[model samples]
Target: MTRIPTLFFATAALFALIGMAWGIQMSASQDHALSPAHGHLNLIGFVAMAVFGGYYALNPLAAASRLAMVHYALTLAAVIVLVPGIVMALRGTGEALAKGGSVLALLSMALFLVAVLRHARGLMR
Candidate 1:
């Protein structure tokens, strides 16, 4: 129950709530782009963060890596960037923030996976 997934879930939920509010208030708009934003936020932020955090928690060796700190930091940064990036896109900003956030998140996840694999290999030796 570290703060990462918790915060991610909460933030994603908030976005979902906002989207729902928009739907309820603006039924005549005919386009619900916010739902897609909410979907991405929940999928990437909540689900992925939970899975990553759970993996690290269950694998003590993985948690002990030097990359663990980097992983967590990058994850937090990605969430920070991602939420705003999603919202900004909903508000009609360019796609740069979303692209940057997605890249950071993907790279961070890849690094964490490498660390996990290395730790698992070490355990086999």
Candidate 2:
């Protein structure tokens, strides 16, 4: 409904498309080795983002804050890095990317908690 929610939904849709494509590719090739990474991409990228968007749409105050934008950025970074990072880790590459992305994801969720406490409180009234 609002700008932030719209952005989030758009991002979620994109991630869903990517995840679906990856899934189809895997199925066609009969190689499920990267399924875990694919699952994370859909869960964190699509589902988490859509849930955030819904929350923001319902709580405009939370969506309006600068912290909301920060949350979105952190989430975007997490999905972007984490998927590839997991792939690398599974392939026996260095784990720096996965670790960094995991931290980013944690920070994103932490900021989201702050948003709920700080801005979404009005919903309780």
Best candidate according to lDDT: 2
- The residue pairs in collision within model 2 are none
**Candidate 1 residue pairs in backbone clash:** none
RMSD of each: 4.1, 0.8
Q: What lDDT tens digits, residue by residue, belong to model 1 across residues 13-74?
A: 65456546665655677666666565565566566766776776666667766677677778
lDDT of 2 by residue, 1-125 (tens): 77899988999999999999999999999999999899999999999999999989998888988888888989999999999999999899978898988998889888889888897558878
- Quantify all predictions' global Cα lDDT against the true fold: 0.68, 0.91
TM-score for all models, in order of appearance: 0.69, 0.97
Badly placed stretches (over 4 Å) of model 2 are none
True-vs-predicted CA distance for residue 8, candidate 1, Å: 9.0
